[model samples]
Target: MKSSESRLGQWPLLAEAARRDRLGQALLLVGDEKGCQSAATALARWRLCEGSGEEACNCRSCRRQLDAHPDMRHVRPETKTIRLASVQQAVASSQSAPLWSPMTVLWFDPVTAMTLEAETALLKSLEEPEATTQYLLTAERRDQVLPTVVSRCQIVHLQGSIRASRPFRPEYLADRGRDLQEDLTAAAEAVRGRYLQRPDPRLLELFDVLVEAHGGIDRNLNQELTRETVAMWWRQTVGPD
Candidate 1:
């Protein structure tokens, strides 16, 4: 198998940025889903790959690195927010040199999860990154990140490309569904004990089906379902039991 360093696709702008060593303070990959993160990660990997040219696309290093490489670090939230612990690990990792390549790459995905504390901690490392350390950060909303963090990173807004793969399941679908239901219940109880605003039974039933499907999103379940579910949940909860 060729290395990841050797198999990077040619993106003129990114190539120029890397060729000029204008990695700048950092790189921000803004996207709403996994597809965006993957693209951003690929770009970061290609830039840091040890191939002879801009992106050889057939080197052993490139291949291995793209699939899973020690030199490439991906930081994400264990839960909803990027906790301080994860940020600390990333910081420490950034300080180290690549185990296989000349440079080390770090990609922070779904940066929206970074809590205030985590962002503060990350600022220090981003301000003075290691000589060979480079970062590729992805966020759904650029405004969600602190200005300080954004200022230190080169903003690369990715649009339209959808990541067509799934990562490992973190939580069971039914459990997530129950959690959502409970959240809805709590919200409903908060609005002056109103029960009339309870979500539609049909919507809840659909969610139950989805939970059973275990993250397998069906085409039949359109965006309207999501909208209706949330609306019903809010309406029911606000009205009373």
Candidate 2:
């Protein structure tokens, strides 16, 4: 939607979907955090834009979304896990009509952090979606989310790392649980350091796997399983490192 193409450039399919009005009621954006958020924000703007197709016309609705409009509700985990209360609130909010815009947008990030109970509640909301409301869920890896939850949404996978967009700034990461953020940061740094040293194609693949494993961890997957998986990737890439 914005003139800059740093983040949304990697998600041409999403833009095409918006332009064609083929966007589903629920969308699951999977990939790097910043990239997913950027794409989601772009979709929100596109949906509310007055221009034909994906081109943003800088209309009042579009400007509101860019300025964090009340009609656009953002849901992120306040702690290590997304609680049931948050999911309930989201569901309740979805039932209401937009205050100013034509439709309401619910933006949920890092959905892998949702607890089983929370996700179950969200699944109900997804099953009977409101026609006037749309959902945008983001996660690092699709596998980390429940298949039931993923089933109800159109999946979009971003390929390249993009600059974080406005409205969903890096500071929002602090609200996703500080410890989890630190863990992901440390894991990324470690894998990045190794990749930088070797610069091998295989190492890059390993880094991707490691990123998925980090998402698994956020989903409360078995720690031993994660460790074994990472170790296996390490063996395959760097040979016991």
Candidate 3:
């Protein structure tokens, strides 16, 4: 596994901007979901740091740790989809002034989880800006996000390729079993992102394979057999990575 330092090293400009407190108001991070989420956390911690601690932080931020930073709010999907209410609450929080830190950070990991209405509500927040609030949105796929939302922020692609040659592979339908539904959705969305980047017909076919496998699993088909079948399909389709 790669360390955060190694992963973040590829994004020097973002790190420099964060350290200097000059990052833009909102950023659309496109990459692996875990990597994007971690990047957002690191950026928020640096942006709110007081430049006084031995390791990183000092003062109020130090007491509770950056993990518990008062001014940082991480809004993720409680279920498979982010509801409008959750987005609305996050918007209200962002609209408020910062408390312990110089700025407040509104982080939405994998903004693709947001439902249609939720995205609309979030768009309203993006349309209206507060001087002290910074928004960080991460998505495993690009096309899954609304163009309006994408236009509101600077886009950053943090990864070179989809880790899964295809999403929802019977073996990798998920990323370590975080959540079945969410993982499946994220996986398909990720494939869509890959297709968008290269306009590959193969990616769409891979995505279709994922959906069919999902349906089979939902019907209580033998998971082992399903996985084997999917693996074979993947091998035939993609052929040796």
Best by TM-score: 2
Quote the positional error of residue 20 for candidate 2 in Å. 2.2
Model 3: lDDT to the true structure: 0.65
Estimate the TM-score of every prediction.
0.57, 0.60, 0.59
Measured by TM-score, how close is model 1 to the native structure?
Answer: 0.57
lDDT (0 to 1) per candidate? 0.55, 0.65, 0.65
101-211: candidate 2 lDDT, tens digit per residue: 667888777788888998999899999999988898999998998988987887765643232221222232234344442343344445555555777778656656655
Candidate 1 root-mean-square deviation in Å:
17.0
Model 1 regions more than 4 Å off: 1-11, 53-56, 65-67, 160-241
Per-residue lDDT for 46-124 in model 3, tens only?
Answer: 5565554223334567456655777878888897988889888878987777887767888887789999999988888
| Cα RMSD, each candidate | 17.0, 11.4, 13.0
